[model samples]
Target: MTDEELAISVSGLRKSYRDNQAVAGVDLAVRRGEVFALLGPNGAGKTTTVEILEGFRQRDGGDVSVLGVDPAKAGADWRKRIGIVLQGTGEFDELKVGEVVRHFARFYPNASDPAEVIERVGLSDKANSRTHTLSGGQKRRLDVALGIVNRPELLFLDEPTTGFDPAARREFWDLIRQLSHQGTTILLTTHYLDEAEALADRVGVINRGAMVAVSTPAELGGRHQATARVGWREDGQARFEQTDHPTDAVRRLSERFGGEVPELTVTRPTLEDIYLEMLGEKEEQQ
Candidate 1:
């Protein structure tokens, strides 16, 4: 896509601490108004790369652009267009939720209503409660509230749902959808493969400071083209086979059984399965 279609652009990104290369020649692009997930195991260069994109850390060498400006040199005006929710709680001890949100809103010129933002993050009930009294998931919601109070064009989320329970996670997903509907671009980093599959339009996997792959969650690592495993019970035994045409295989089995195939199952690789396979292959190459 063209530059106008992209919210973030990077090429040959590199960062190092002494002899340890935290990010080694990474390249990434995020399209405008899309939810993109960056996935990797701990110690991978994902954090370094994201920090560089967010302009929180300097890069050793690379061309980096975020929202049409190099983040390294971006001023306050540019920062106003970008929002970031880091990996943990936004600890504002002793302050009530409403007070914290109102304080942050003052930092942005075009801030959203503090009360609306607090309610949007499902913290209206906790608005009067002190920050230190909030639960882990509630704290995360507060972090998100602060991040988006500016009504930023691009939002960066690092493990935004880390402490959330299952229901809370689904709620957060719906909130993300609402933000995307408002034309906000989001870059998310998470260890939860299922969350990535559900929320990301595309996912990029990183390993050993390099990109393993970048594609839509369904098509990543050719997962959409991978063969399906068809299994069935037969003559007091179990049989299974991998086939590109699972429907044809099932039809043949049905004919042999002269009716519905007993205990039949057709399975394809899940996003987690594909992610693990890609990581494993990358390790073998290293």
Candidate 2:
């Protein structure tokens, strides 16, 4: 699919179980070949929303389309073009890593080469190892390898790096970047704000089953243009001020000091900071 086309679209999506609403009137659109991140605290309905799009669950009310076909009415061919890496690990513990990936590759009409897939996910060295013997990070890589074995045009990654260490997370991010470069549309949900900032082209924040905001990481909650906090040492104590124009503040400070301002620092809100503030506002509103 071309980058301009929408891979998935949802409008007025609502799901309720008896008296509790899991998803409440949500609208989302994912562009082809883009890495879109859905961020929110637990119980924010992110899982439910993704399930609806994946055709695994029924929605109470909404118009949902995936790859130009309504997910609720999608056929086998429609399903073939998508891949899902769920929160849970795979269950082929007894099989070798290559055996597991090769087995899944058969399910798709046109699958990637098993060896190539393993190498792509950085599992080449462990390709002969048994799945049960792999470490947590290795197991997660096995999951990813299986997910893309089908060569799906769209992929869903739900907390794929949950058990990964810092080094492993960085390596996984590189793998994701390679997939995106190949024009694979991805929908990612993760608790790591830094991951979203590093990988996503755009981010959508959902809270209490509702989307609070959608924008680039820098622009979310107007963070890119938000007031900057300037701090410096003065009279043996730290003094700080917030202003929209930090350049002017720095210039003034420099003039006052006739040189560098001691311990000077200018900071803007980070993605996590804005995200937490948005969640706090949502709580206050309720």
Winner by lDDT: 1
Clashes of 2: 0
lDDT of 1: 0.93
**lDDT of candidate 2 over 1-286, digit per residue (tens):** 3423999888899999889898999999999998999999999999999999989999999898888888989988987899889887877878899998988898889999999999999899999988999988889889899889988899999988887899999999999999999999999999999999989999999898888899999899999989999999999999999999999999999999999999999999999999999999889988
- Candidate 1: segments with Cα more than 4 A from true spot: 235-237
List model 1 lDDT by residue over 179-285, tens digit each. 98999999999999999999999999998898889999999999999999999988889999899999999999999989899899999999999999888988888
Report the poorest 10 consecutive residues by lDDT, candidate 1: 277-286
The Cα error of candidate 2 at residue 85, in Å, is 0.8
Q: Estimate TM-scores for all models.
A: 0.96, 0.96
Candidate 1: TM-score? 0.96
